[model samples]
Target: MAKISLDEMNPAMKSKQEQLLGKFEKESKTRQFDHYLLAQGLYWISIIVALYHFGTSFIGYPATHLHRSLHVAMILFMTFFLYPANKKASRKSIPWYDIVLAIASLAVAAYVWIEYINFINRMGSPNTMDVVMGTILILVVLEASRRISGWPLVILSLIFLLYGLFGRNLPGIFMHRGYDWKALVNHIFINTEGIYGTSVDVAASYIFLFIMFGTVMNKCGMGRFFNDLALAFAGSSKGGPAKVAVIASGFLGSINGSAVANVVTTGAFTIPLMKKTGYSNEFSGAVESSASVGGQLLPPIMGAAAFIMAEMLGVKYSSIVVSAAIPALLYYLGILVQVQLRASKLNLEGLPKDQLPKLKDVMRERGHLLIPIAFLLYMLLFSGATVIFSAFWAIVATIAVSMARKTTRMSIRQILDAFSEGTRAVVSVAVACAVVGIIIGVVSLTGFGLNMANAIIQLGQSNLMLTLFLTMITCMILGMGLPSIPAYLITATMAAPALVKLGIPPLAAHMFVFYFAMFANITPPVALASFAAAGLSGGDPMKTGIQSVKLSLAGFIVPYMFIYNSALLLIDVTPLVALRVAITAILGVLLIGMATEGYLFKDMVWPVRIAAFLGALLLISANVVQDIIGFSLAVLVVLFQFYWKHKKQIA
Candidate 1:
């Protein structure tokens, strides 16, 4: 076997990586200012925003509206300087108009607090100046979202705003009493229901701080530790590089919370390694993309959507994390099974042990990095700490823990850089949350959520299975081109309710939508994660996306399984039952992988493949009779495969 080097892939990988990120994730595409003044301004502004949020984690947030307002203001002020309005615009310096817009954004956000008493008193009826400021704030957010997230979010927000203003003229259930400009602006901007609603509230508090925690940890060499650790354990196994991608991407992507970023970060190394080890380009990219996308489904730092889910459900954030743990593990298991099976089928060997990091050595060298994560989990799950408190201390713990080794210790400059990066990392997400506030505001104001729910229920003819299917499609459509946080907020508002109306548990319904929303990153036509991976692996993007869907087939099914048996979610179940469900679910996912990959102990015939798939569905049914039937079918297939192999050998 040929030796594989990490640096052996495309020479222009970095440039391609940047191009792909810019293409699919506009939020990451920002100016690296050549002018020192503009650079310093962006840097300090980011630092101040990061520090403010960090401070609030201890000092406590201001009044809700004031806190969200300041968060949005800082976000907008930084966005104009960071993301240029046009590609042709200057990168070396800020344009004059953008500077004006920045100050105006700050002033508009400040107006709420300046007239705090009057703002509260005039909530029902804003004065002229209030309306003017509200209008400016709305426009400013729309423009900022445009620069950061591109036209999809901006256009969506505008449509919702228009619907709020003009839906009265429409016929049928969509119709509502339209609000004039003053009323609409007052409700959306002046109140906490629109731009300052729950979505922004989560972003302002939990999401931003968690993002900060991730960046700070990354600055302290956590990413390298995760990659090296995964390499140590998985890089000498069957389909080693692909398995490494799965493990490393899952670890990093969960905290980073951006599939595109995760793909570029881990895929740069893993994709090439997989290709060098004989995996097809499309399959390699698919593995990386699928794994990176699944990271958001993991915990304790699942996606930003998990934070929103906790807020909406009125559950402890730790509960959401706990419930997500099993299904997330099952998702990765399915991927790992298929990767191993593919390696077996192709007779591909693992990387030599000599070429891999020693697990013990890896643990000894940088094992301390895991301390902050353990501290976070303890605070969240056992200590019963507030999410903000846990996150703040986690950031502090990461810094303190980094001091154990000179190699990992963060200097003051590095710590400040982490703050700046953390704030910068959250820009697009924060903007998406703020804009989603418009959708939520419209849904609340116009009763569109209920109407949409009714429409989905009506379309499904009140059938639970059909309703789930419709909801899944609805989530995918709405999730396309949107960040996961906004996607979940929109889908949970519009689609999840339809499932709940059909008697699904509220958490189950929300999880259903959340699953599909995150999967949109690997769905074809607009699969940002897959496309990013393809760019790295030099594979066809659409093929990579299709492969990703196949590889993640179990993820699609897990939601439905949990919906059928809440025990899968660890809701209303005993420890024994949960364990039983988890074990069966693991078998079910592995069976599905075998069916998908068309291989098992030996090459699976078509009948064996079909039986494997049918058996998987049965095992996942979470019924005693069905599980028996599924297990029997699996055993029969195994025996039959052995018999066929013997007969062929005799021939």
Candidate 2:
């Protein structure tokens, strides 16, 4: 109900936000220069890089190798100067060695462009100069990835590289005729299939543009508009604070696509409000984290991973958007219903309606911001525009629309700052994509993806359910501590193939792994989003993570449901069947909420909770008989609760 602004937040809360972000988000742990010369240099360099990508969106990409090489070069140069070598390193100025590395980065990237024709001709048999340049590029990328992406990815990439070079010494399905250093370097550097492969290609092509679009929108005040709009609509209902967290986080997630960032940004405002409304600290943190993680599943942007999926699957990005809509809704719906029920159980009341902004007034002031989003979706789904074309225009539209309201207009300085900030934001992701490209390259060279798929299939022994469980575990494990793009890339390479082999449709299989990879941010043992929320809420991280898992129960199940019946994905199904499936799935998720919350009309008994849980599973499954049985069971529980309430009143 209150006006929200970061500038107005308490100093203690602001410090906590910074600490939590630094601890949980690797990308946020960067050196901020206080020296004017260093700061100005970094700013202009970032602006130049951003301008280059912006120009490409209009002028079109260059040759594949040239484009990707330049992309990696720019990212590495910035990364070396921006991120310190370690926690103890100086922040105010760049180190001399890092400067040297930055300059070397240009040389590594420029060699391909300088020797373009020669490089192409020597792809299989590289000369001495090619090998030297390739080796330097590989080392620079690894070091840059380590600095920006953290150690887990660096370790994983190194392991894959080692396997590529030394697989002959291994046993069983792992064995391969190991290639020498020159051959491996040439494959990864000279050829497109290795470091310059699809992952980096998508990063250079689509992800950077969308990142800029999100930044421009944020600079023009869309973030505040989303918070206000969500508050206007949901801030006065029962359990409204938690509902606001879910709604606002979902809206922000579509733009930012980073769970920890989303949690830290929105949770700073919403978590304290939820706690004030009688929600437990852990519950408040869990609510924010769960809702934030679900944002990656939200269509339109879906964290940039959707674009990569489109690239991988050879389908329109709009198709991923369409298939993702229902499931994403189900996830948020589950959180919303559970929070509402919890509020009822605890007798928590919403904020006063008079204290809330009127929906009309809020829309009148900032509703124009919605135009770019709507236009972007229309172009993607109906207008048949390319993703790059749609994204570029969307950025332009955001800048144009901001002028409609003087309050939201972007000044030249603000525009330059957005470009600088957006380009800085992309460094970590671009590095991760480049590092993951090594893994993809290794898989291609060693047939490791097929081998891993066979290993999983053989281990599961053709039982689809068991195999799905194994794949889910693999995805969650791989996804922990990794951003969703590379997480999806890794799992899609290693685990999705196993599902496809088990007769799961390719889309459903990839979606299955994608869901789990995203969920790892809220799963226990390594829940970065939940930990960030906990820091903001002053709750226990492990408890917050566990509670988040309970809140996100439906997310864990919906993937399997879609795998069992592609109708959930709107694949190979008629409209009538899809509508029916949607209704039952909604009901199932609601029951899951009721079961997990332990309340329906009144506090549910253990037997009733168990029944609700079972009914939820049945209804979620794709079977007519199961749906009927599940619906009947739900009705009986509702009737029983009413009867119990009446008897208690009589007593």
Flag regions of model 2 displaced more than 4 Å: 1-7, 649-651
| Error of model 2, residue 23, in angstroms | 1.7
Return the top candidate by TM-score.
2
TM-score of model 1 vs. true structure? 0.97
Supply candidate 1's per-residue lDDT for 565. Answer: 85
* Candidate 1 runs further than 4 Å off: 1-11, 648-651
lDDT of 2 by residue, 1-651 (tens): 455443455788878888888888777888789998889989999999999998888889899899999999999999999989888889877889999999988897788889998888888999999888888888888888887767888888889999999999999987988988887887888888888998898888788988899899999988888887887888889988899999999988977878999999889988988998899999999999999999999987898878889889998887898898898899899999999999999999987787777789888888999999999989888998888888888988999999998889999999999999999888888888888988888898889999999999988998898899999999999998887788999999999999888788888989999999999999989999998999999999999999999999989988988887789999978999999999999989999999999998899999999999999999867889999999999998888888887886767
lDDT of 1 by residue, 1-651 (tens): 443333444668777777887887797679899878868878988999999999988989888878889999999988888999988987777789999999999998789889888888899889999989988988899999888877888898899989988999999989998888888888898888899998898888888998899899888888888888888888888889999999999999899888899999778888888998999999999999999999999987886666778889999877788789999999999999999999999988778988777778778778999999999889988997887888899999999999999878999999999999999988999988888998898899899988999999999999877888888999998999787788888999899888888888898889999999999999998898998899888899999999999999999999989998888989988999988899889889989999999987789989889999999999877799998898898888878877876886767
TM-scores across all candidates?
Answer: 0.97, 0.98
Lowest summed-lDDT stretch of 10 residues in model 2?
1-10
Clashing pairs in 2: none
Where does candidate 1 have its weakest 10-residue lDDT segment? Answer: 1-10
